[model samples]
Target: MNESISDLTVRKHRGMWGWILISLLIAVIVLAVIGEIVVHRAMPILKGRVIETLSTRFNSRVEMEGFSVSVRKGLEVAGDGLRLYPQDEVVAAGATDPLITLGHFSFHASLSGLFVKPMHVGTVHVAGMAIHIPPREMRQQTPKGQRHLGKIKILVDEIVFDDSKLILGTIKPGKEPKDFELSRIVMRNVGPDAPWRYDATLVNAIPKGDIHAAGTFGPWNNESPGDSTVTGRYTFDHADLNTIKGIGGMLSSVGEFSGQLNRIVVDGTTETPDFSLDTANHPVPLHTKFHAIVDGTSGDTYLQPVEAQLGGSEFTCSGAVVNVKGKGHIIDLDVNVPAGRIQDFLQVAVKTTPVVMTGRLRMKTKLHIRPGPESVSKKIGLKGGFTLEQIHFTNPEVEDKVDMLSLRAQGDPKAAKPGAEDVHSEMVGEFVMDAGRLRFSKLNYSLPGADVMLAGEYTLDGERFEFEGKVRTKAKVSQMVASRWKSILLKPVDPFFKKDGAGAVIPVKVSGTKSAPKFGLDLHH
Candidate 1:
């Protein structure tokens, strides 16, 4: 009877322990369900707080959806679409309001002590985003005026924006709208305090081929507004030059360029940015540096008084002022090409025709372009002067006795153009050839030629050209002169006024356009 009572008591104790274990498990599950319900109920509030905090920090309107929070871990805020607007009054015309639209964005925030403080975001990832900047018309309507008006500036900490589209438009009155589109762009940021570095490899970029760029942004400290600077290095590989020309409205012959820049220092308070470029193996291997001041209030003018050293040559050029408008910009530029070795350039222009020439030439030109106001009618006028000394032209086909000659000529820039119709549009100059003889310099052709001295003054106006000169021949060369004229004109050769076949002096006149230049002789012995 005692053994039976002990076994029954032991079994009852085991059954009671098992019942307690089952009740404990049920209680734990009930507590978990209650905790989950509480979290679910507070999610909207948590999301609202997040939106409020971000909006206040960035001074922009922010929106998000689908928020989840964990007690010990962190908050996972996910949204099908997110948007941040520049201002509250911005209205989207004919479509949904143009806000920075992110297809899907998520933020993981580190939990703070019992929700007493806002959670710290560990990482924010934005995928399949589209950022649409409002047109200039909408911006201009803002009360802040033109300077601070337009587009929402974005700041993100450690973001990954992928497969995005960005559109920038300039709306002007009475003119077609101008817009720029960036498609399929991917960007990655490192850290908040770290430089806003980006590694973007773009394919089918607007005007040309694929481009890959990796660089770091310089220090950007908002406390000291004037102390901001940006330094980067970019390389363009096999890009189309024509596309570049279309964008900048400047002619470039280069196909590829790679270079490094020290820094781009901009002082927003002072409205000036100093930039430098060190490039090589380009169309015109350039090592250029310049500083420009941006207009603080108007933002219309950019002034650059630059000095550059290119191709071992010193050049001073400046866009004294550049005015930026809706469609394009206007530039007032002055350029000076110093006197340098002209042999290489001459060789290229003339080819290898076996002619030796030596001299130095200097040029100064001005170019002005107002691209927007008028496109095709843009006027380009060139004015410059050049001097050629010790100029010579020789060929083996000519007389062998005198194979070398020297002369000089100077001309005005205005008259250099072909078919310019102005009496004053004449390139006035004088030339003298010595140390060699021309077979027909004195209109003579007797066997071997004549010892002739030639000097002339010429003028060219449009298609009309005129030359007046005198050629004097000694007695030993007078007969040669008469015979040459006879052969040339098929007439009896005789000196108009000759005494015993003595030396004769003849006055010569050459006139007419370059197309049909004519020559005449006035004999006076």
Candidate 2:
């Protein structure tokens, strides 16, 4: 009877302890569920703090539409219409514009960041961001210790940006700045310990081309920020050339770039399907393909081995453009055209010459062009030689003069069109020219009535043609300037009409343009 009573007491005691443990476990579960609701209620207070914190960092005004937290309301920032203003101190030359605009920026992290550790952001998404940099001339120079984008450091893991654009202006005063944008900007492994890789789409490139590029960049070492390098390749297909500014009407280009993003080395190829001397109207159709190797940074660009083709003409050139920083462009080029029609290529290449040329020709030339508020002839120089085969002359006034010569030399004057006339010759010359003048060192003129050695300097692009030269005729004066019916007119002009031993030499003064040449005696001689 005593053992039975002892057993019942022990069983009752164990049963009571089990019930106590179950009640405590139920209480803990209820509190945890209630905590979730309490945390959600506190979001308003937390959101205010986040806005204030960010506003201080960029020295700008910041705002967002709303905030929603996921980790029991512990840590995360979500919602849209997040914007920042970096233009507070700017006094606009025109209407005020935001320096940077962000449409939506969001990120999330583990709730443990509140107590145990800093937030380890897993992903960040930015969308509809537009960046417009101020022109250097508009802003006062930055102080010595201030931070600039090229030297700044950013800490992030993986970032994705959609519908983003960036505009960069030339920092040097007075130079035209470039405007460009990138859509679908994506970068991965961007932290200090990781190699950063990116892919993007370029909008509104030169010649109104759209480009796409893929590249690998830095785990930028903060120790030496300037040393980071970037490498990439790009393709621009079937661009509308009419939309490009300054350099007009061309198409199709591809390129590769390597080195620092701020200063890079590049090479590319371009093709134009319809090339023209005047881009705005009456465009001529000619195909041109060009390959180039370009180097240097903002103020200078060196172009070596610029090879091209247009119609039946081919050109190879090497050049450099300097002083792009402020003083305007100074250009140097060494070029060779092994074979071509002079009429087809010369007018288009210069873009400013108004003369027409005719012949099959070969040429080699060197040019130095420096333009300024000062004198043009003093700074510009051109030295070259040319060979012309089956040469024909065309200007209406010249054609009339040539017809008169034909009549005097016992041939028909009005036989055919100027280009189809049966008279032809081979000519060679060496010359020097500049923006203001062209000087022929040696020229040979051969026809049925006249074979002459000529040398002169003509005012280039001037309204009036002014030239003086020594013309030594290889034929007699009467034969050169007279016919059987015109001997009476020649005897008074030249005393050596009948004496043809060494021919006649005259100092000729020629004035007026190709259309209205007025020849007179050289009174100065």
Candidate 3:
């Protein structure tokens, strides 16, 4: 009877212990289920915070299609299809698209940051991001004393974007906004109040080059974006100027820029080893160092001054490249050359192999090129005056004729029969150019003993040359003949040709082609 009691007591104790173990296991499973439910519920709260943060920071409405957080991977957060509307109510009302959009983004953060005021995040990887800046008239201003997002702040260690773009809106109706492709963008220390350090790689539209830049981008001024500061250094590489219709070159540049987005001051140097006009088809080394202000909105560049060297010719120009409504870009420049080589200009402007004339040249001109499908030479318009000193024609026959004319004008007609030799001449002219035709209004040409005042037109193709003028000489017409009999014969006409305090004055006309120019007396004139 005693052994039975002991066994029964032992069995009761075992059953009681088994019940306690089962209850404890069930309690643990229920607690885990509650914890998961709480986490799932907190996700919505976190997403709401993110949306609110973005909205307050940009002062715009924000929308997101999907958002998710995973604590399994050390607090990873991700979202998709995010868009931020323009702050301007009027613009937002008429806009079919948002000001900023993101296809997808992901970042990692510390769990403790959720309880902090300013959450710190690791690199935020973004894809398919685009920022569209509205036109100035449509831009919205933050209200006074409302620029900051009161207390909540989110500071990013780095934000990286791959294959993004920026579109600049225009005020012109029916015109498309300018789009710039950004292959890669990285911003460090991105926050609402401080300027972000950025490194960006983009493709240039006009000359089709690749540009890499490092800069500080913005503490954005939402009210006036043009007032926001930006500073950067850039390198433009492998720019093919042939992308432009009428010019050709392989260009490279390095520069630094500072100022706002709309009005940036850029100081840069460009090098083109094979710069050439398509019409001329002769390559020349071209280089320039320039100071310019670029209007980002209008796509215009204003040159304070540009110092350029093409081959051996040096010139300085200041002007604006402006975009016309119906036309493309109009390049209007004021060009000045204190001294340069005429051969250098001809080598780049004319198609001829051996240049026609060589001289020391001084020029000042207003150069205009209208945008068109025409070649650069055909579209170039110039109104200018130039002085050519120590000018000499390249052709032997032309040089001989000039020498002969000089000798006869000095009353040494016998010596005028000498063979071809170098004879220097000087010319000063005011010219206007249209359609490759150069018209000279006031042309003063001088050799050893003769001076000529002329008006003429010279075709760029060397096709036609026509000039009519008066030639004045130090000698009388009677002394202008090599033969004694001819001199006596011309003595009667000497008084008729003498005028204007000159020994002899005669009307002259030059005509024919460049290769075979004809010089004759213009008796009618």
TM-scores for candidates 1 onward, in order:
0.48, 0.58, 0.85
Q: Candidate 1 lDDT, tens digit per residue, 1-525?
A: 999999999999999999999999999999789768756865665666656654553345676544556543445556666676655444433223534677787766544422545444545677766645445445443444212222221234556666665443334332332222333333345333456665554454424655454556434332211123433333334444334331221111112211111112221111011111111011333334444543322223343555554444455666644435544555666766675433332332222233233444354656465554332212333333334433322332221222210000011222323332212111112222111111122222111112223333222111443445543344322233224554355223335523344344456665554234455564431
Find the 10 residues in a row with the least total lDDT in model 1.
Answer: 402-411
Ranking by TM-score: 3, 2, 1
List residue ranges in candidate 3 displaced over 4 A.
1-43, 68-76, 89-97, 110-117, 140-142, 148-153, 170-179, 418-421, 512-516, 522-524
The model with the greatest TM-score is: 3
Clashes of each: 2, 0, 0
List candidate 1 segments past 4 Å from native: 1-39, 58-74, 89-99, 111-114, 128-157, 163-169, 173-284, 292-310, 320-333, 341-359, 367-525
Candidate 3, 228-345: lDDT as tens digits: 7889999999999898877888999999999986678999999999998765778999999999997767767899899999889899999998866555778999999999999888
Number of clashing residue pairs, candidate 3: 0
Looking at model 3, residue 292 earns an lDDT score of 99
lDDT of each: 0.41, 0.58, 0.83
For each of the candidates, the C-alpha root-mean-square deviation to the true structure, in angstroms, is 13.3, 11.2, 6.0
